[model samples]
Target chain A: MKSRFKTGIVAAVAAAGLLLSGCGPAATGAGGETLTFMFRGGADEKAAYTKAIGEFEKANDVKVNMIVTTPDDYSTKLKAAIAGKKVPDVFYVDPGSVQAYVKTGVVKNISEFVEGSDSIDLDNIWQYGVDSYRFDGKLMGQGDIYALPKDVGPFSFGYNKTMFDEAGIPLPSADTPYTFDEFVDVAKKLTKDTNADGKLDQWGTGLNVQWNLQPFVWSNGADWLNQDRSKVTVDTPEFAESLQWFADLQNVAKVTPSVGEAQTLDTYQRWMQGQIGFFPVGPWDVSTYEKLPFEWDLIPYPAGSTGKSATWTGTLGIAVSNSSKAPEKAVELAKFLSANETAQQSLVDAGVQIPNLIDMSDQWVKDSTTKPANKQEFLDIVKDYGRGLPANSTYSAEWYDELFKNIQPVLDGKKTAAQYLKEAQPKMQKYLDQANQAAGIG
Target chain B: MSTITRRSTLHRKEQRVALIFVALPVIGFAVFTIFPLLFSVYASFTEWNGISAPVFTGLANFQAMMVDPYFWQAMWNTLFLMIGIPIGLSLSLLLALALNRKMRGTTFFRTVYYVPVISSIAAVAILWQWAFNGDFGLINQALAMIGIDGPNWLANTATVKPAIIIMSVWKGMGYSMLLYLAALQSVPRHLYEAASLDGAGVLQQFRNVTLPMLRPVTFFLVVTSIIGGSQIFIEINIMTPGGGPEFASASIVWYIWQKAFNYLQMGYATSMSLVLGLIVFAVTAIQFRLNRRNQFSID
Candidate 1:
């Protein structure tokens, strides 16, 4: 009986030990060196990364583990990982999140790596892409580079050629700029009610204020921040005017679908189904739209009062984590992922992103023989007029998010542009001030 | 050793063995639940953003809560959501009484009713979102057929909360009904016969015997549902991105999540959570006190 009891205790202890082991930190790979890379996107993005990582692994003889998460859940998961002290070796960083992440000291400064490397040519890469990751130890967009740009996403419109042809409207030229009034007139002409059911089945365009409204706001020579990024300037007449024009597309002009109508079939789906006349397109949408039955092509954003088509440029950068066990290996992986010509070309071929290399972007645009006859327009916008979101300051995201949140009422026709901005500017300024205080930035 | 001593030794041995059997769970409860609970309570007093080291901030977070309109709005929304509990409980009782009859397809009906309880919240939220959609949803179409114009259920601020409440009741009613059905089955038939002998009708019997007997179950459901309703997160998160059309459907837990995860204000989030926990405790205590007077003991 004593022996049996002892055996039972031993079994229980073993079971408890096994259960506790599962809760412990994750094990390293079987090989000597292992690097974990976390990124955000769906299946196609995952597939592209998998292929690239597979090539990297074969070449270096080091195992690379890829963690893919949806864009919505990426920040939450990344933060949780950091808090748990299990930060990935490398991760995708966005400009809006750079300052916040940098304050935590998790993002490694890749300046030394870049400077020491013989492979990557800093001059050949876009200056804006590199400048976005630079921080002067205190302020962002200045000093040493912390990350390398994986790709640059320039905002433009992808219009359906079939819709234009069916309506007997001529296709827009790559260089020709449409004024605000002309753009609205074209939108009005494109909207139709095919079945005469008293409800329009087709929309001229769709406006997602967060993504597509920047071009309009910027083109009108209005901005959310002042020259030195010290104050909120969105309450100006120019800003209100642009916003009102965008809102009128949906509310007054009734060319775009209402919020309720859009919920049924989102703007993206409507664009895919050839129901929308114009929708914002990024290089990432090229692969998704390849299967579309309609012929679609890119066009520069319509010019506002300034007669200059200014659009926001979004870039995803490859960053090394400070918690990485093998920082050297991780840097190599980051370099391979971001700066390697072959890897960039592979991404370009997949139509996942435009090439980050200045020289290769032209090749990328010309190489795509499919739809988007005006693919060069994307390059033109990026080269001539593309600007990043007003995220040069640490407090930029807080103010930008506040603006996006408050501007919805204006779009819904619950409030006019002037009225909404008047109410929201103070709130935006408050958030900006708080964020600046937190970041110790004057 | 004396016989008493031997008996005491055996008893002590038995106790030790039981303790050994429960040791794993006790350790788990301590490490995972109790420690986190205590840590969060302490964290509420700090000014940590999850990444940086926490700085002691005393009552600043609580003070901020006083002036924070969003926090107050979330609290009001949470309380408003609990309005569904009483309505849900009454509906569940009715369902229980109906389903308690000796029907042919009772098992099938019971399974059908309970299915939503087992369904994942994400799946249910998506399903209900589609059903509540304004333009192409089935609910609006059904209403349209009756010559009534249905409002945008999820989009309109006025209708969003009611839509959430309706979905919550539908999803949760079955579990409450099952509890009621069990309680009803346990009620002695002799008591009903006695009531009938006194010339009581079905409704009178229900009021006099059924309701009185099910008081304990009702108390349990009420307390649990209130606590559950206050912590509503997934449904709101999935159905309404950024707390819906004007923060109309934002609940306390959703607000806490945004403060913690979205803004990285971990300390503020924990403070709000602590406040929510205290509120739940006070509400539960009051419920217990109210029910204490009834003194329904099975023994």
Candidate 2:
């Protein structure tokens, strides 16, 4: 009797397993193929994607599930999904994460798909955007492609044209990058009390030290790391000099908002309200910046003694998950987001970013009637002086963060930049060493 | 003889049924708590990035943690924030005593105080972030009216932890007040009457009668508050996303979460978390032992 009961249980289990296995092929059959695409963006970005994704769905004859999150939550959410082994079929992968993803085999090597696709014109896309996602096992920006660029963010500099005109200050030349000395002089005049009240309502510049200081540092021939990206080199005199100059913008020149005033409104909001004279503008800010009360135009960021302009370009790559069952469809979805002309046109029209296609952006630059009248500056940065973010080449951003962790004292002018960086290098190097260990590099 | 055999078989069947009913939580405990805890112990000694196989690295993570200034700073910040627990407890006790009297609109006051206790923590954190802003914030504006200048509450290192502690106390005081209120009312009136008859004043009576009666609740609150305080992440994450000016406001849990998720140093994070868990465990154990030793006084 016991033997019969066991046999009955075994038969039932067999039937259940068969029933579950039976549904797998049916779902993958013809029109039933579904792929998940995850990316982070704001409202306009979401609208642009929603409008563009349908064409891809119709063309591929498959369903696509879209997961959109705010930029702040994207990395954390993506990491959570990866850890749970439920990675989206295709998702936004940044240059910074390329090494970690490839090392762990989380991302598919989609070089062949990207290179061989007749629809994608690699020659027409920005080389820097494509190279940023490449990893040769030892270094980033060169090797097998793991993802395709969604949008290349050129961190262009924008000045309030209204503020410049109202103050009767000479407009900055679009082609010539202002020397740091000349830039500081203009900023001093731009910083003022427009209402003649004791409290200053207007400011020249309000740049976060973490984000905006990089441009000055790089233009000064100083960097967070050495050329080979192996060691921390922020203790150099050039870095300290640039760092001190940036601090002096607020503490000495009083051109930017005081720390207390900034805590209330922050620099970004100040720019939106036409209070700030100069600010960094990314391609992603176009849609939001359109409705600002003041006129603004792009120009090269101020140059240091090096006589060169420098700032980072940010990009997100759409990567296929290695674990995806529908790899071909997933790869196609990535390709569509990156290079499909119709999709790129729609997204550009939505005013979220410049077109990923270089040929398309050239035409975009020709349109001089926009809020940023000097749209050509955006292309120039993408094609030239804009460097990949320092963190992009590292295995993790902990070392980059270490540079900014105790920066407040310097910013407040309580400590000199030289002393601060001198003390900070070892701490940064420790984290860099940890990062190398993680990347399986010395 | 046959009847006896059948009765014994019925008892065995009932025992089996009872065992089946108890197995669910046992299985849950094993899966959820015991398994992760055991895995964490193993992972703490290894180099795991939450992906790929964990390689045993023996005490490297712990050794690094000892010299890591950020780790120590985070620990100090977490411990510093618990200073509010005692301050909050005293404030709640005073409030409970006030509300215990036959006051007008006691129920309304009770409900109002408990509102924050039930309000969403994230929303509260965001609301407080705006209020603590420096130039034009509610706090500085009020301070300015009194001929005083307020520093940037969330931006300055010295003020950031206090600002967070103050917000935490405001959010948590209501819950503790409610518990103390319940404990206050449950104290026997006869004890207070006896104390009063023995020439004890209100303060004397409170110390002799009310304090003793509230000991158990206080013990419970202190243990739980320390545990909760140790794990504070939401307020810190929202109010000061960059870990609050050199990480002066980072708690152990927040640091652990950053290491595990943001930095992808899961093994190091796990080791820090294990240290945190053991600390909490030791603290709770000590509290329980003390409570047991002092049980006679309450009795």
Candidate 3:
């Protein structure tokens, strides 16, 4: 009886092993045909993408595995996935990451796909958006297009109209720009202590040095790199002066919150709570800020020494991965996400993104359902003065981050701007030179 | 002779069954742990980004480490974080001693203390970030009530490390307390009774009886906490990203992660990892040696 029981157990185990062997290939074969799409965004952005992706899946009769990650964890997770040889079929690509990703041969050049597709209207899309992903073998912005822009994020100022009214200050016109000095004066007036407390409860303006500070640096007629991108230009006196002026808004002018005060409630939170007069607003925040108790409107950044309001524009693009099994289908999905007017309109209506398609931006601006009275200002900046960041080369993010990291001491009034820039220039130049060499650029 | 043959056959069958049972896990260890360790050691000697082929560059990464000020700063920050371990261990021990007595609601107190250990690190970090805020934080508000101004706990370079240490101690004390509680339960009751009969006070009895009896548990806690404290990453990452006001709170593991992922300097990151691993191994070895020399009864 014991021998019979042992035989029964062995037979049962063999049958189970045979069943598992049969299941493995069948499972993979069925799922291998489905495409995977990965992106990074907050809740509203996710909801918009979910609606669009659902439409695409239903129309194409193809399954898509959507993966959403936070902006902080996206790069780490993507790199790990690539290293593990489980690269997603399509993924979000940023302008800063384009060169590095392309150099590593992870991103596919979809120019052939773009050229052949009759459905995609390249002429309708903004040229700057197209140029952002173009790589000419060695240099970016000139060659084959690796991705298509999902949205154009033009950085502009969003001012609380309710605060302006309460402060008895008239709203600034979108076309008429304020000089840096005049802007600071307006900010000083807007700052107040409403309840007559010893502490000031409201701030004039807030500046995120990492993001919004670029406009001031550019409008001051100072550049991070020279025209050719060969040498660091941040050591110039103009750059130092511009940076000092912006830093002084908090440290010297005493209008904005101190670094310590800002830590308690970030400028964004303060702005949402109707405590900040002005803050840099991107199109992505339109959906989030719609429910604010105060009225807000967009305006151009204040002009500086250059006599022009030069703003920084960022782009998020969709690209097919090189390791994708379904490259053709992935490119189709990328085009659907980025180029198709129907899909783009959904995102624009949701107030999460500005139109990437030219002429179609009027539709985005005319969407009366959205808040922000001066939506036209976003398009004006993008069309006239929007510029990408200076750190566009491969392996340059570290160097760019280093500049900001080391400059915190200067912003805190511990070091002079001139002194910090002089010390940081050589290190930044070294990184730029190495990155140029790595990317085979001069 | 026939009985001996039967016994040998049964022993061989038992051995075969044991091998079959252990094979799966041994294979998993080799694939997941051993293979990566060996590969990382090899990669440490080469120059490779995650995407490209690694180039042979002997000692270059190690040479770079010698002059890297950031690496040294990270090490210093890691050491600074370890200062909390001793303070944490002592506090936990006191709590364990108080709770170990047969008192009402001891289990309730134990559960309350253990809650933070089981809570998610991200959640705990967000809670602590709010508490450490300079202007409106609970800590600063409390300080203000007593006519003392609180420094910007997280934003100031001078106070950031201390703030991190305080949070670390609060979050980790529960684990140590439980361990000490277990050790206290096993302590022979007669040892304390004898000390009492000798006219010793409660404090003297604790020092003479409880502490010496709990030495092994203390030693274990010390060694493990040091190893754990020196590798703090999540707290710094969440509270003070980009090293928090001039890289004041960046630990060695945080630096390693930045190099590997942010900079794509995989080879350099691996080299740093190997060095960190060696440092941990050396410290643990010294602790074991000291423990052996003292000859504390672990069992």
Candidate 4:
């Protein structure tokens, strides 16, 4: 009986060990240290991160467990994790969401961690990158630089080189980016029915009737909300004219596919398959297009009537969760991940994303494989000329949602652009007013 | 021991054990369900932005909800689905009658029809979306073959709500049919035979006999369908995101989700949810009253 009892205890111990080691607790190194890293890109991304952690572990006698999430639902999940007091040690914070996360007190301020650290250099970081994470001028990233902008997704218009060749148009040059009228004319000529069928076989461009069209409005020196981010500006003459031009691409010019036809596949999927030309996208598309069979090239968006080229800016940064058990250790990991030259190079080699460090971006620009396609041209624009929407802490997401909903009718040709703007602004003003009041920003 | 004392002691011990067993579950319910519901009710009257302290706002939320056009649009969309519940029930009843027979492969057919009942609504909605796609969708292809041009199923505002209603019926038909099938089985075969001998035709026999027999099941299905339809959130979320092409397909639950998570109007969202719950409660009460008056079994 004693022998049987001993055997049972041994079996139970073995079972517990298997369960605990599998998912609950990561294997410990010699120092028995574990660091958690949360990032946006999951799937194949975890492999690169796992390798990085292996290098970090061998160098520092610390084990790192990385949890990667898709960008779409990560913010909502991160917020929930913080609310439940189970925040990850380190996570990515996009500029769009940084304001909201900062207000919640769930993310730690990292000013002290960076005050005099020689381990990471802050001088090499870009001003915009630094400012993206700055709250009340006390770098929210602890005294140490919390986040290093590893890459910028700078928006531009792309076209299929094969389609340009077939159409017999000279490739767009820096001196003469297609004029607005010329751009429309080119799209019209490119859009045609090859088969005797009445339906057009090729679309010249994709409007991408989604949340990302704000750049077009901004390019015209107009925006969805007013300067203070307090009221909707959709009804302005510039916004209305922009909408008309957007809709006319489908209804009047017949250069773009209607929403119905566009639904056959998403605009990106269609562009990747070489069915459409001239889509507005970020530098990430260069990486995306590298995997596609089609040969595509990028062009700076045509100068708006204001005679200035415009692009949208999205910055990704590092943030420490307030509920972290070891805030100091977490800040260290965040600093290493954000500002380390070796770490940044490792991320760049995996993909040619723009690093937040201004000095590192020069190397990235030189190393870019998107040549003849010229990925550097877009990065140059972001460095020299680009500006982002004002990131208001109170109603950024709501304002964006409202702008999209109100413009959808205009895109579909159900309402004229002027009519849509007129109807949308007052309603938007109500939301902005409430948000401003809540934020104490009267 | 004295007999009376022993009996009393045993009774007390049994009661103590019962209370001990019930204690854990009662506490669990109070902590998880009852407390949250009460907290939400309190939250509906205040302004709280997830992290901050909530301030009292009285009936401000309700007052605003009364004027919000989107709130009314969502209510209208919900009512559209609520109206479809009866159409779905009657069709299921017909299908259940046809299937309730001694035919070859009857069990196989029954299982096949019951397949969708087990599959998730999201998976079914996605399938319907592909089927409804305008250019390459199977429905459009079929219509093209028949020389009839189909309208854009999801993109066109006029057709989106109808498309959703049709998809909802397709997704929901199997479960109600199974319920009616079970109810049909419980009716005695002798009653049908008696009705037939009394010189009634097939339709007459069904009207006089089967209809009356299935009243209880009908009442169950109608009440449940009303409750379910009034809370339709998933189909709108998955298929008709952005509230259908032009706000034509927005439902109350989807609007509540937008207000709370997207807009960060937590107090307003709570008030909207409470109002929706009250609307459902009133509708169900009215439905129960109408069902009682029209019940075939009572007549």
Candidate 5:
């Protein structure tokens, strides 16, 4: 009887195994030809994507699935997805992580897709944006062009008009922002104790010691990486001088908020709440400031002794995953979303982003009805002074990590700017050299 | 005789049924906990980034430990937190003793104290981060009122770890207090009576009688606190980003996370984690041995 029972169980197991084996492959996706799109904008941004996808789906007769997250969460999640071998068909790739992702063999090389498609437009994008999307002299992005740079607020100093007026300090002119020395003077003037309780009740400037501090370093003719993007250039005298100037904002001038105070007041939120005098920020804050009680103006970051106007641009693009079952369909979706004029215009109108197609983006200038009052100032500064950090693909992840990591001590008055840069130079150079060697950039 | 034998057979069948029911849980443990632990041990010796093909590099990860400053910093932070266990445990014991007697609103106090433990760590971290904020924070504002210059508690290298330790004690003590309460309730009242008869006052009775009786409970608390405190992660992670102000507050577990997830150095992270696990085991073992040796031995 036991032998019979064992035989019955064996038969049942065999039948179940056969059934599982016959169930067929994983979901081939969206009616057997699926394309996945990853983006970092919130739900309101979905309307723009939905309209774009609507047109693409109709044109290609394929289905598109959208994955969305905030910019901050996007990189970590994307890395996990790629590492897990569960990559979506298409995703937004930040310039910082693009090289790392491409090197991992997880993203599809879309150079061939661009060659094959004549309907996509490439001429409308800025040269730097286009170059940023390339790896190994071959385009790794799709649609014969770069991902549309939705709304951009170029690097500029945002200041409270009320504070400046109250202090009797004239606003920095659009033609030329205050020089490093004058900027320090202005910060001190803005720093005042309103309550007169023998305590610092108001701060002159909000000290963002990371990306915001970069333009100052660049203005002093210091670059994070050398011309060949092979070594760190920050240990130079120019960068050291810039760091000293930055340290003075706190230690000598007492104009900038302490790091702990910055966290509590949240420099950005405080600027929006009209508590700060001047803040260096990007276009991300425009929407927040639109509702503020005080008038605000955007001015270019001040030039240093070198007289160079250095403004670093942040570019986010879209790429296809190598594991995607439908590469061609993914490219089609990328092209339709980025190159199509109707889609770009609709997105721009929705305040989704500053569209990247230069010729087609005339609307950003022409749409007088939608443009903010300060739009002209922002546009003028970005047009004249804008430049992007060389997208040294593999090193940006580590380089920026070091940049942001080391700023804490500098801001806290523990390390001088010169000391921080001197210590960080070797670390930055080591990684940049590694990346350059890996990419054969030299 | 036949009926008696039948009854014995029935009893044997019941025992078999009980054994079969118990066997399922043992199989589950072997499959889940035991198997994964063994697999992790093997993986720790390999260079596997979550997605890539794993290569065996026997002890390179372990060798890397000698110069990893982050590892030492984490160890120091763990030791820093160990300071809290005794502080928390003693306070909890005191509270438990005071509340053990029938008193008005004792239940209310216990409930209010446990509220923090039930609250989310993230919520607590947010509140503490603000309170410790260098400027415009409640703590700083209060200090200003007293003409004291408050340091940036979360941002300053010297004060960050202490701030976290104090917050942890506040959040952690109630549970330990409840455990002490349970242990206190189980102690016999006759021992205290006998001590009092021998001319012992309240303090003397507590030291001689109540303490000896609470030895097992104290030993249990110390062992568990050592294990838990050594693996502390959430408070430091949420309150301070990668141990802020140049990693002055980095804990060991946070480094493991940064290496594994952010740096994509999983093999290195796992090896370091193994070393940490061994360290925790040795420390816990030593603690248990010490507690056993020091356990009150009353005649």
Candidate 6:
């Protein structure tokens, strides 16, 4: 009995040890270099990466372990990996993380690789995309390039073409944007009770204040931060006017879904069901949007007093881990993913992203057979007027988030935009100050 | 001398065998629980970005947490959520009593009630998110049938917390009800008979016999519910990604998670969690003390 008990305990301990060891990073594949690459996307993206990386793997003679996650869970999973000290060889990053990651030696400096590569012509890639991943000891956007842009996502505006046609409204110009007043007039005309019921079933526009407010604010010559990124500039009159205009689309104009109505089904679902007219479209959304019941096409967002459209372009960078054992092979994979003509073309064809290359995107624009017919609108924004998300340059986004925390009252029309901005500036500034202090960048 | 030696040898063998049985769990406790607990305690006093070596920050994170309005708001929100505990327990006990009766289809009713407890939390939260929709939701549509228009539950700041509370209670009552049912089944028939023989009315009999019988179960439910309720994260994350409108429904654990992972402020988050741990510990201790005098000893 004593011997049996001892064996049982021994087996239990062995089992426990095996379980703990299993949680560690996967063992290196038998006698060959293995590079782990982590990224965020759904099946279509994973499929694209799988095909594209196959070519790179054959050329480089290395095994790549791909860790995939959805956008929502990606950050938490990556943070867990970082905490465990099992950072992937190549991973997705953004401008916001560059400062902290670089300081902690989490990401490696890759300017030498970029300069030395004969295949990757810096001028061919979007300058904005490339600059987003650049960081020196103190500032972002200038200094050594630490990562390569996977894809630059432009937050472009799309209108339901069928809705416009049914309403006997002329199609919006691809090159020119509608003024705020023109956009409102069009929206009012589209907002109607289609079924002849007591309730209004169809509407002109449905915009989330957090996302849609930025284009309006930027076009009106206002911004969330100053040139030096040292101060919060959200309290200006232009910003308030843009905000008030956005709020009035729901409260005063009633062209958008009411808060109560939105709770039943979000604006995205409404747009998908042909109940709403205008919505924001990202490159990543093309495949899904293609299946929508209503026909839609890209348009420049409605302009403010400046008569110019503005929107935020989001990009994910492929960064090399500072602790990577196979840095050269990992960097080769990153380059192939970013700059390889076939890879970029295939990714674009997959409808997951616009071509990251300037020349390739130009070629892509010439093909007018795609659903969006006006694909140039994506490039126009990316090349001409698109700016980084206001929070992208900051060390932390708490400051950016503080601007929206109490913004409901304004959207509900309980508070004026000017009053809201006045109350919001100091709160945002305080968080920004804290973020800067944390980064030790003051 | 030989007999004494043999007995000592047997005793040592028995002790060794018992200790070998206990060894695995003890090691696991020390390695997984005790080690992380001590590390977090130390981390509470340091500035750790989680990627680099930790630097001691002394009381800075503590002082900063004290001034963090959002942290206090989360704490209050967490406390507000605990109000559902007693409400849930009371309703569950009533359910347990009803199910304890000799009724037809009691088993079916029990299974039906326990469905939510078995369902995944993420799936349930998503379903509830849709069900609480203000216009065409299951809840609002039912409310509308009674001549009332419902406000948007999650979109509105006033109703978000109450909406979450209602969801959580609906999700949690089944498990508590099952526990209470078992407790009720164990209550001795002779005790009720004795109370009735003493001329005790139904209410009096319930008060004198049933209530006392349920004391232990009630205590267990309250303590477990509070611990579970205080660490509410999954529901808030699913239903209200940005912590609901105006940060109205952000729980303390959700806030800690956001700070640590999303914002990469591990040091500050650790400090907040340590304080939260202390608060939960003190509350549990106080409950234990309060229950000591009133604890029903079957012996």
Q: Summarize candidate 2's per-residue lDDT along B58-93 as a digit string, tens digits.
A: 999999899988889999999999999999999999
Candidate structures ordered by DockQ, highest first? 6, 3, 1, 2, 5, 4
Mind giving the per-residue lDDT tens digits that candidate 5 earns over A1-442? 4664565556555544544663454464445476778788866567777887878888887878788887657767877777646688888866655555555666667766664468665566655565566665322322333233333446667778888887788777766767888888888887777878976756778766665667788888876665445566778888888877777787778886655566635666667766678776565555555667887777667789778667776666777777778777887777666667776666655554566677755657666554354555556544556666544345235554666565776766777877788888777666555444433354
Candidate 4 — which residues are off by over 4 angstroms? Answer: A1-39, A54-67, A137-151, A196-198, A264-266, A340-352, A356-360, A368-372, A389-394, B292-299
lDDT to native, each model: 0.84, 0.88, 0.84, 0.71, 0.71, 0.89
Q: Give the per-residue Cα lDDT of candidate 4 at A235.
A: 77
Which residue window of length 10 is worst by lDDT in model 5 chain A?
A: A137-146
Candidate 6 positional error at A212, Å: 1.0
* Span of 10 residues, lowest total lDDT, candidate 2 chain B: B16-25
Q: Could you give candidate 2's per-residue lDDT for residues A388-416 as a string of tens digits?
A: 99999999999999888899999999999
DockQ of 3: 0.49
Model 3 CA lDDT for position A60: 73
Which stretches in model 3 have alpha-carbon errors above 4 Å? A1-32, A440-442, B1-14, B296-299
Q: Candidate 6, residues B41-75: lDDT per residue as tens digits?
A: 99999988777888998999999998999999999
Docking quality category of candidate 5 according to DockQ thresholds: acceptable
- DockQ-wise, the better of 3 and 4 is 3
Q: What is the Cα-based TM-score of model 3?
A: 0.93
Interface RMSD of each: 3.3, 6.8, 4.9, 7.6, 6.9, 2.7
**Where in model 6 is the C-alpha error above 4 Å?**
A1-26, A263-265, B1-23, B296-299
DockQ of 6: 0.54
lDDT for model 1, please.
0.84
Candidate 6 docking band:
medium
User: Could you give candidate 5's per-residue lDDT for residues B215-285 as a string of tens digits?
Assistant: 88888888888888878888888889756767777888888887776655677788888888898899888
Q: Candidate 4 chain A: minimum summed lDDT over ten consecutive residues — where? A: A137-146
TM-score of chain B of 3: 0.93
